[model samples]
Target: MMPQLRTLTMMRGTRARILRKICRNCPNLTTLQLHGCQKMNYSLLKYIFEKCPKIEKLIIANNLLADRQYAELVSRLEHLQSLEVFENRRGAGPVVLRFLAATCSKLREINLSCDYHPLEDVEYFVKAKRDTLTSATVRWTMAGKRPGCLPLLQKLDLPHATDLPDDAVVTISRGCPPLRHLSLTFATSLTDGALAEIHRLKHLQILDLSGCSGLGGSAVAHVAQLAALCTLLLQYIDDLTELQPSLRHVLDLKQLRCLDILYSGHIRAVAFEEFSVRLVNLRELHVTYEEEDEVFYKNVFAEMQSQMPRLRIINTFRWTENDFLTDYETDDDDDTDIGY
Candidate 1:
């Protein structure tokens, strides 16, 4: 029996009996991840929660817990601070969310993406936990109105939120004033009007607008207003043309460190070279080009790297979805240090 064990992860295929033994043995565990573990059931989960009373971070992604069972199971963990329970059999509804808002006073971070739930229920939970929650990841279904103010919220990730609208961006900007990190990845319906609202988040550091095809050069112009921005992702923005003229606007962001422009073919080599020269603080640059334009970008990037000596030019073609998943997971883990 490893009584001193602090963290345990059972990735998959662990039998119920083995899990019971492990949980019984590791009573002092603080972080337990059962991602993709197919054998989990209500009785085993109840036993594990009772045994691991000190757990602060729990990840049960791809499990088979029903909404009520998940709510009941989580309510037992009074010390839980961070949770990631994605792609469950039945998505959490008002019962689970209300339970979290009312009982989980220590909960700080939650990721429910890929789960089917109404936007209004999530809004209620966020409003109730506004003072404690710093980071949140949820799917947007366009069924809710503007959310209430979340004064302490810092990071809000709505990846692949295809139904997000301009008014919602305005509402979010008005609500989350101290936001530092915002990811609206693949929200293709957003236009420059939404970008205008996003610029209101003056404290924003990392902004990912990947796959927002409705935006043009004006979007960059709006992003340039965020003086604190460190990382900017514009991957798959097909309409962001006439970019050379707007490159000058981005130069105002002296703190910009990482810029991703993968699959944005409108950016010419000359414009990229000109922009790269002035961004002295830039450390990483991600770009992708067709086979025909490969040599052109290679020469430009090579010269830029030679001149800068500290820049890392990455080819987006080499990256996979797991890369992003790992990054987001790491971010969630790091946020556990925030005091409740």
Candidate 2:
């Protein structure tokens, strides 16, 4: 009497016996989302995957699934093309990831989040020999450098996984030669050494180095070298005392469409003519300042509009300061990060 559903979502009170009975009837289900569930019994997870062998996407968030059960997920979900897991319990470790690399041959996208980050575990996942990977997102993980190569990878997002050093950047660059989108927001340990390595990503289009306090404007000169960059995010950086001068070097990146510097509190003011004159393709501009610099920003935006009319300014006239849409938890170390 019930419809042949392809999606199943349950938030709480997902009992093992009840799930067993339900999964048996949903043989065609391709997506399963378990949200905010306190207890994810191993039997239920195994039974669901076993019964629904055709699943393509699986999301497990804010739940208490044991380490073995998470391992069960990687081993059982062989047909999964997408997997999103929020392992707040530190269940997603090296062993689980290594198994995933060996078993999930068709996997393409993975978003992995962790709490109380285990660096070795994440390193194993990143360095594992997964040949089909293209997009990978990581959060609160202490992932290390590459142990192997990944030639086909394209997009990598690691907003707050801690302890990524410059060497880690170079390693990932050498490992994943085709990376295009990279986010290393708040990676405070990265220096110009890391930026120097970033130039190797010749195809890189979008880059987010916000809140990386250790880097200087001199270090940012390499970012300008990325000719293909379309979106550049340098928001909330605390140590950029020489930002204005560095703006000149990036004028060559004419393909840029979006630029964010709204919360880079250390940057006092940037001359419009220095940037707007060369950024003919720019569409969005995000900027913030001390009370003294508000007038400076306004005057520049006004002059820029007169010249390059297509540019869009965010929260310009009525400046209301806002937090980063997504800032994360991390510690002081050197490396890049991404989460799912």
**Best lDDT goes to which candidate?**
1
lDDT string for model 2 (91-154, tens) is 3333356566667777787776554234565566655635677878765344344454677788
Compute the lDDT of residue 249 as modeled in candidate 1. 72
Overall lDDT per candidate, in order of appearance:
0.77, 0.70
Local distance difference test, candidate 2: 0.70
Candidate 1 TM-score over all chains jointly: 0.83
Candidate 2 ranges beyond 4 A from true positions: 1-32, 38-54, 62-75, 87-95, 116-118, 138-145, 266-269, 316-340
| Model number with the top TM-score | 1
Question: Model 1, range 175-233, lDDT digits (tens) per residue?
Answer: 89899999999997887788777777989999998887766556677888898999998
Q: Show how many residue pairs clash in every candidate, following the order shown.
A: 0, 18
Q: Work out candidate 2's RMSD over C-alphas.
A: 9.0
